[model samples]
Every structure is written in C-alpha cells, then in structure tokens.
Target: MARTGFDIVRSTNNRGGVDDFIPFEATMRAARAAGLPVGDYIDEVMNGTPGATQSTIDRLRALGVFAANPNTVLEIGPGSGRYLEKTLKECDPGRYEIYETAAPWADYLVDTFKVVAQPTSECSLAPTPDGSVDLVHAHKVFNTVTFLSASRYFFEMARVTRPGGRIVFDVMTETCLDAATMHAWATKGGPGHDSYPAAMPRQACVDLFETLGCSLEAGFQAPMGFASTEVLVFGKGS
Candidate 1:
C-alpha cells in the first residue's frame, strides 16, 4: 500500500528509534556474554537511580493509585521490562500482561516475566477483558502515533481499565517537537508544526483524558532523546 505523508513520517521515526536500540541490545548481549545476570544488566541500563518505574510508582502512590492494591497490571510496551519488574514487586498484582509490538521484545518479556505478551496495534486490549485491569500503562508508546490515533488509544485504555483504576502513559511534548529534526519532520508536506500533529500538547492530553472520565493527578517531564517527554498520571472515575 502507498504510504501517506504521516505514515512515512511515523515509519521513519520508528525506524530511527529501532536503529538507536542497537547500542542497548549490544550492551545487553555483552553483559550476558560476560555472565552478568540479565536483571542486573537491565538495572544498570534503566535504573541506576529513580528510574521510570520508581518515578511512576511514586507519582501513582501520591495519586492514590494503590488505594486498593492493584490486582491486575498491564503495560503496553514493557520496554526492557525495567518498569515491569518494579510494578510486579511493588504492586504485587495477581495477574500481569504486556502488549509489545516488537517480536524480540515480546519473546523476551514472555520468557522473563511469564506474562501474557501479544502483538498490539491501535493500542487495543482485546486480549484482556474490558474493565478488568487495575493498572493499564504505556511508556513512550503514544509519541509514535498520530494525534487522532492517540485519542483512540486513550479510549481503548479507558475501556479496558476498570472504573476507579489508573492509566499511565508518556508522550513527546511540544518541547520535544521543538527540536530541529522533529520540527522539520512535523512540518513536512504541511504548514507550521504549531498544531503539534507529531506530538501531544500537555493541556490537550489532559483535557482528552478528562473527557474520557479520568482525573489528572500529576504531570511531569522526563528525559527522552534530546528533548524532555511528558508523563501523565490519571485516575479513572467510578
């Protein structure tokens, strides 16, 4: 199928992310070859200090995300499984699932965590029963999708997460899009990137989540490439 401009841009950006993974993968391979535990290797790479998982947990705890002790936890990417390990240890979920688009990562997640892992598209959670999971999350996943797709993904996240549950996700923000590369890519075949078609605006994402019956708890910036990414934590309404 002929790709549209948006498709081309998204494909190219995704390839760039994948290409950048070479170093991370090579480091892991070398660590394993040297007889280092994979978990320790992952920790060295992802969690030297307050990493994404701990940061998320701290925010969620502040937001009362664990008022009832989450029983089911689902992560969209489970990237390196750093957050997955922390979530399992801290949340003590009864059931765990992960949706990973990359086959190698999916296999690694399944093998390591014994979690139900599947290929996902459109951020769908059909493999999980609706309104069942206590926590549905994705890290650095929404940034790659278009604005409209992000909204749809949010709807799916709301649908699968139980009432009063919590959903967490991160996105590239206006700051990230302001970079020359991102700005140029977003402006390709169109006007200015002020509309932020390639990234979500902070207020816009908050409003959308609010309309989806989620109440914003906290929003913060974390590192992503050359720009800072935004992390949003929301509590679903009953």
Candidate 2:
C-alpha cells in the first residue's frame, strides 16, 4: 500500500530521518526566515497574540462564518488546540469535532479541549454525517494537500454541512508563495516543496464549492501584516 501524505510526514520526521514535511513550527520558521516578520504579523492581526487561533477566528468572522453561530462546527487539523480554544470561547458551537492525523497533537487537543477525536483516513477528511454540522472550518490544511485531496475534503465538508450553513477555510494564495520562502523550505527539505500533488488555483477552489451546491459568498486575501493569505467562505444553497 502507498503511504499517505501524513504518513510520509510523520515517518520522515521520526528515527533520524529527513524533515521534508511542513509541520506548523517549520512553516512558521520558514516564514520568519523569509523576512516576513511573522511575530509582528501575528501581533497586529491577531490582537498581539502568539498563535494563529485568534487570527483564524477574526478571519472567519470577517468572512461571516459566525453569522449562524452557536451551531456545531468541525475543524480539520486543529494544531495545539488554539483554534479549538478560541472556537469554544467565541463561536460557542454546541459540539466541536476536530479531525487530526498528527497523533501527538491530536492527543493534546483531545486532552486540552475535552472533545471527541474522529478517525480520519489518510489524506482525507473523516466522514462527517450529511447535513449534520452547521459550519466546517480548516486552516492551512489544504496547502499541504494535493488538489484531488482538497476536492475530496471540500466535498466531505459540503456533505456534512447543513443547508444554509457555511464552510470557512484558508490557504496560501499563489501570490503568497514567495520564492525566498520556498528556497528556505527547500534548504530545510520541508514538504512545502514535496511531491504530494499539485495545488489548485483560487478560482478552481471557488468553482468546486459552487458545483457542490454551495454559493461562494466571500473570498479574499487575509492581511497578516507583512504577508497576505487566502480566505474563502461558502454558504450551502437551499
């Protein structure tokens, strides 16, 4: 059997192997090394906070993700439970389901947030019940995945979301992919340049949602001080 992207990432980092995978820390370091001023970016956009949780929350709100809040929300790849914490405190979802393939991080999140851990297939989002969740959110998860994997995840997100609910997520726009950053990542042998699969364009992402019976309400670059990121919000059509 072929190894999944998560498997390759985990295996490469273990047992004195190469770290060609794009973990959260390495990505942050690469961004900083590329002279993006990640700290200042986080502070200014995330209210001077140290993590991407608040920044994600603010971005979600800016995309009108919470317009139908107090509903169940599913977040894929909730690293360190920062987004989970913010959502619990702010979004107040009736139930928060997190899907993570990283075992250690998943364990930490489960312990810290006291939420259920749904089993996820390799390179795929877990099977969320149809029309069960009010909102689905993912942060930077799609950047590491292939276009096909992203399409599958988006379809799953649409399947789980209730009619009139929304899906909010972010990615590294083509403009955001700096050559200097890529060089650093290359030097580090990070997965940012791995052969997982090709990435889809921003317009293709919008088209995927629209074809799945969702309306793209908003899509734009999220300002993170020195760098710009892509954010998209989709509402399920009735």
Candidate 3:
C-alpha cells in the first residue's frame, strides 16, 4: 500500500510545533529504515532514556489512570500512537478519538490502533463534546509547543472531559528545570532541536485546572528526549 504522508516543508526559524510535518516525516523515514516502530526508534535511538514510552505507561497505570476503565478517550498529538497503543491495551476504550495534525501519523494511528482521528485545529478539542470523554490526555506535546497553545489545549481538555473524568499530560515544569537539567537542555540539544525545553509553572497548572473544575490528583516524572517532564493527572469534580 502506498502510504502518502503530508508534504514536509522546511520549518523556518527552527520553530517546532504539532502541525509541523517535518518531524513526523523524518521520524517515519528513519523508523522504516531502522526496521522499528516510531516509538522504538525514539526510545532506543533518540535519547538518554530508553524504554521511555513504557515507563510512562507504567507510571500512568500506577497513578490509576487506567483504573477507571475509561470507556471513551481522546488524545491530542498522538504522533505514531505509542501511548495510544499502550492505553488501548490497558483499558481498550470503546471510543478513542485523536487530534493530530501530522496527516500521515494520524492515518497510521487510525489504521493501526482503530482510533478515530478528529479534524484538528492544533489548539482545541472542538470535535469532542463537552463533558463527554472519560479520559483526555496528551503525551510529550506540551513540552514543545508554545505556552499559549498549551494553555488553550488545557482549557479544551477540561471542556471535553466529563465530570469525574480524567485529564493527563506532560510539560516541562519546574521539577524538570533544575540547573543541571537546564545545562543538559542547552548543550545536549535534544530531538526537539529549536523550539523546545518549554517550561510551565507547576503551581499555575494546578491552580488553573482547579478553576476549570478539575483538581490535580497526581504528578510524576516522565522522560522526554534527553531529560524529563512532569506528567500531571487531574480528576474532574461532579
């Protein structure tokens, strides 16, 4: 089968984003060349952390994100569907929707994971109805995108998740920005080459989610390219 992905245009200014297809295309090309899944290539070749994706899944499991047996789930920027595949194994959610701008990766996920790929606006979960999703999440996304974009998506996550539903995502929070980590981020120049090492205030994340009717339930460290990110889990109140 001819797998036609989106056209890859050179990203100007080293600006990295969810919609930028360059990373998606390049990762696929390398993965195919390496005889590995995108996730494996990322884990084995692209970082100081190996087995990063499964580690995140294990942590989420420990946090009870999988305990609810969520019937419906929505993920933002589920590139290559590593987390999506793991989450499906954990709970096998009946209605799994995804919003991804990399057309090829989105199509790959839809085919491989049997997930619904929603039309994406890059910063909103408009296709998902308010209070309809049992679990809404993103992985390794907030750490690369701009601050305003992550903030907008946070509001949208809260909007789509049902009362008592769960929200989970990772960001480069204060915990991830120690002096040594900052040095590594600057010098190591991880996979997110240009627009990366983005940081968000941890307190602000908890405080804003609280106002959005979700309370921070748990947070833990998850590995990104070369360093780590904080995955915050929130539970919506009834």
Candidate 4:
C-alpha cells in the first residue's frame, strides 16, 4: 500500500528530524493569528538580528559581508524579504535575482525588494547558461532538498557562475538533528517521505562541492539556540 502524506511525514521525522522546516504560509498565518509584528519577527529570524533590526544590521556589518561588493547575486528562497534586505545592503549587487518555489513568498519578495524573482519551476542551475551570475546565495534552502537534488542544485550553481565566482549558503548541521526531530513531529508520515528529500550530512556537502568543481573557501559552525548550523563559502572553478 502507498503511504499517505501523514505517514511519510511521520517516518521521515522518526528517521531523522530537521530544523528550518517552517513553511512560508504557516509562518504568515501564525504571525497573523498572533497579531505579532510580522516584519519584526521576519527581521529578527531572517536577518539574524539578536534583539531587533539595529542589532541585525550591526551583526552583518561585523561579519565583513558589507565590505565586499558583488556584481550580480542570486538568492534562493528569500522568505519574507528579510535576507533580501540584508543582501541588498551587504552585497550591493548591480542586478539581483531571487528564486522561490512558493508563489506567495515569491510575490512577497518582489513586493518588498522591488526586484524580479525567477520562477523556480521554470529555471534551474544546470541549464541556466554559463557565467550567468557572480554570486549565488541560499539560506535554509538546502535543508529540505534531498542529497541527489542538492547535488543537482550545486551543479546548477556551478554552471551559472563565472569561473571565479562564488556560492554562499548555510545548512543545519548534525548537531541540529534534534531540531530535525521536532520538525518530523509536524510530519505525520513515515521516514524518507517528504516534499523534498532529507538534507545531506556535512561531509556529504563538502564532497558534493568538490564533485561540482568548486573549492571550499571557508566553513564555520553557527549556533541556532537548539542546533549547530554551518555556513559554507564555495568558489567556482573552470
């Protein structure tokens, strides 16, 4: 018998939980229902602001991201435009494109950034043509993508980047596996069943980059209250 959606969710959760599982719609609804400040919450989480927007700005600046200027940048899944704002301020790219699979969030990104975002359905990394971008950035986008799909995405990133361009993204580490478990509870189905495949392990991520002809420039583990997070910098090669 085929497994129901709930069963898939449950099994996936039981096998290993995930962090960064909040669907865009669910977050919007919760914010609306709580009458909580949507923009504030978004700024806090997406921007990495500690107490508020000012702190977020300060932290980003301290990270040296603002010092470097990228010519063109692509951000995958810029939920609520929080990271959108940060990228605009820090990267200061001449042209910016955001890729979002979720329609409402895509619309929200456009409204907030006043920039066009490519429909994820129509675009991909592999067939995107060569040297299309100077930088590719993804935040929490890889956590839900399966290892095989993640491999494809990395190839796409490599295909679009100039020989010297870079790809920057973050992922939840094994240390954050507990968060994955909690996320699994929200899933009702059995293991290995999800909208996307489960995330790849850290070594797997490193290997994927090497396989795609990119070199890991830097990697660091970040603390996210509950789990360990890793931010990686990849430089594309010819």
Candidate 5:
C-alpha cells in the first residue's frame, strides 16, 4: 500500500512511542487554541527560536564555517518548515536539502521552499558525496529517537559534512527530566507526558560528538516546562 503522511506519523510514533511523536500542524493548532504565545511555543517548545536559523548562520560566519561564498546546507527533520521559511529568505546558501519524516511536510517544503526534500527513511546523504555539505543540522531530533539511533545518524552527518563544516542539533537531557513538572508527568504517564524518550546527559552527548571528530563550539539550554532542550553547535574535523 502506498503510505500517506499520517501513516508515516503513526509508524514514527510507534517506533519512538508517545515520547517521540510530533504532529506539527496539530501542535500549532493546540497552541493557538490555548492562547499561548505561538512564537514562544514554537521556539521554546518545538525547538529553534525565532531568528535562530539566521543567528546560527551569523555565528557560523564568525567561526569561519562560511570561508567560502556558497554553502551547501542539509537539515534532518525540519518540522513545520519554520526555520526553512526564514532561512530561504535571509540566507543564500548554494544548495539546500531537507530530510523530513512527515510526508505532508516534505511535500510542503518542496512546494513552498523549492528545496530538495527527502523522506526521513532515507536518512543518509547518499547523493551528497562525503565531506561535501557545508552545514548539517537537525533541530529537536536527538531526544525523539533512541540515543543509539541518533548516534548512527550523527555518524552519517559526520561523513557528509565537510572538514571545517558545522553541525547543530538539540537534545533533551537528564537534567531536563529533573524538572519537577516533568518528573511528575513521567510518573503519571498522562497525555503529553514522556514526549521525549531518549534523554541523555549533556556531557554524554558532547562526548559522543567529540568522538565523531567534531568539536563543540557553543551550546545552551532552553527551558520548556515539561522538558528542556540543549541546543549544540559543533565544527567537524578534517
């Protein structure tokens, strides 16, 4: 049977369970219905603050990631296309590619942004030769999958990212789970609880990236009420 976008969502949630599931449009609707600050919900909750993509680009410029004029960029799981929408207008990367799990979003990204979009199942950048991409990134992806799975993806990211290229991603950590509300929710097993399964210690994630031949450049914690996230940037080694 040909799979639909909702099928993809169902399968992903099955694999990662309740914790990893993210229904982007539904989330937005819920947020709007609740009268929450949509920007804050999208940024702090969904990951990647407003202007985050551009700010990262600027930071990359400072770090020499863009020593060359044209940059090839790849991002995994660019949910809701918020970052892409802003980045396409703000920065002129030589080429842009996205790996998105939700089929509807994948089509939307291609139609809306005119960027190459691949299914999340095709996680590795096969057509993109090794060490070709200037920047490889994923936002709010690590904690959604098992750490083991995320590590595998990082290995692929390392392979495709050029020497001196940049990588950015976010992870939920044990410290995030220690938040009182989060701990209680985890215990209660209520709806919207345990929405992240693969929380790791921040140091552990940094160590993994370091072992993958990347050097941590900067990182910060964004406090979401249920689960905080650590946004990290790294520079790949030759």
Candidate 6:
C-alpha cells in the first residue's frame, strides 16, 4: 500500500507516541474545504499568522530576489510548497527542483506544481550538480534543525549554486531574541524539541558565504512560528 501523508507525518513525529502533525492530512482537507491552498492553510490557519507568507514574499520582492530572473530553481525542504507557489509566480523557473524529506509531501508538490523531485538526503545535496541551480532556498527550515545540520546544508547550498545565483535561507538569530520574544519562547515553547530554533551568528554566516565566493546581497527579518528568523540572501560571484 502506498504511504499516506498522515503515515509519513506519523513516522517522523512519533516522539513519545504524541504526533502533533497527524493532522496534516486533515489540514489539507480543511484547506480544500476553505478553498485555500495547503500552503495558505499552513500559514494563515495552522500557523495562526495570517499574511505572514506574503509578507516574506513582499520582502523578497523588495530585496530584488525575483528581479534576478532565475531560470533554474532548487528548494530544500519545501514541505507544502507555500513559498514555492509564490516563487513560481515571480520567476517561473523552467526547472524547479526540490529535495523534500517527506515523501508524501514531495509527491504532492510534484503532482500539484510539476516540479522535479530529486533523491532526498539528510545533510547533502549530492544529487544536484555543482553550480547548476540559479536560485536555492529554504524557509522555516534552519530554525528547526541543529547548528551542524544547518551548517552542512549551508555549505551544500553554496556548492550547488551557480555563479551569479542566489542562496536564501533563514535562521533564528540574536535579532529574534529580543527580551520579550526570548521570554515568550522560553515560557511558551514548553519542553521544546532538542534541536529547534537554531541560532547562527549573522557575521559567521556572512563570512562563510564570502569564502564560498558569494557576497551578501540582502538580509532581512521574517516571521517564524512564534518569533522571527533572519533571512540572508547571498549572491555567488560570476
């Protein structure tokens, strides 16, 4: 039998037999019922942050992410393809490749948006060739992983992006740790997942990408679960 989305969700989120993500299938149902896309439902209803997705897209617009006119796009872990949906409207890359861990979600995105799904891995982009993608990005991803996991992905991101391409991703940084936000995260987060809400210094990220032959083009703040993450855009030198 083919694995259902709920099965996939359960498999990954079965810690202590409490899977908060089993509702993923139901969430898609609700999204259809409300005439909203799955991505919209994840942002506006499930995340309880109406318009947050568009807000980040707007910031991307301001930062000239779309204006670069990329033709080949690669996304890391585009769970519901929320940002990918809008990104298609912005650039309509001819080849939209994705590496998503959730099999059901990857199938959904491939069937729904006609994207190319590559073999998935934990910390490597080995299936994608070096300097092949014009734009590579991950959203709401780094925040939930460990420092080393995020760093490994960062290195791969830079390696696969072509010169003049852009690599975009977000991380929970000191900027998101204002006193109130920190208190809320500490108090409300409630027995948090061990690797969550990873923090990487902004300077370190800038320097790492610089050595990889990319220069910081733009950086900005974007909303995450209950706080914020810093989105960094690095342009590879031509």
> Which candidate ranks first by lDDT, i.e. highest?
3
Task: Summarize candidate 3's per-residue lDDT along 1-238 as a digit string, tens digits.
Answer: 1256544443322224433644666677888998987877877876546789898899889888899799999998887787888888899788999987777778878888889999867587887889999999999888778888889899999999999999999988999898998898778864645666578999999999999999999999987766789999999998
In the predicted model 2, the residue pairs found to clash are 20-191
- Considering TM-score, which of the candidate structures 4 and 6 is the better prediction for this target? 6
Clashing pairs in 5: 19-195
In candidate 6, position 175 carries an lDDT of 78
Misplaced by over 4 Å in model 1 are 1-27, 33-53, 175-198
lDDT of 6 by residue, 13-77 (tens): 21221223224566677899889888888888878887888888889888888896899999987
lDDT, candidate 1, 126-217, per-residue tens: 77788898998887667655566667778888888889888888887765556585755545523432333356787787887888888888
Better of 3 and 4 by lDDT: 3
Q: What is the lDDT of residue 134 in candidate 5?
A: 80
Q: Which parts of model 4 are misplaced by more than 4 Å?
A: 1-39, 43-66, 175-197
Best-fitting candidate, scored by TM-score: 6
Evaluated against the true structure, the overall lDDT of model 6 is 0.81
What is the C-alpha RMSD, rounded to one decimal, of candidate 1? 7.7
- Give the range of the ten consecutive residues with the poorest summed lDDT in model 2: 11-20
Q: Write the per-residue lDDT of candidate 2 for residues 1-238, one digit (tens) a residue.
A: 1223222224211111222322545434545765654334334443334444566677677666776574788888675565666677666676888887666666656776777778777534545678888888886567656666667788889888889888887766675557874564456543534642233577777888888888888776654433445778889987
Candidates in order, TM-scores: namely 0.72, 0.70, 0.88, 0.67, 0.72, 0.89
Q: Each candidate's root-mean-square deviation in Å?
A: 7.7, 7.9, 3.8, 7.7, 5.4, 3.6
lDDT of each: 0.67, 0.64, 0.83, 0.61, 0.66, 0.81
Global fold similarity of model 4 (TM-score)? 0.67
By TM-score, the better pick of 3 and 5 is 3
Q: Which regions in candidate 2 have their CA more than 4 angstroms from the true location?
A: 1-52, 123-126, 175-198, 223-228
TM-score of 5: 0.72
As a TM-score, model 3 comes out at: 0.88
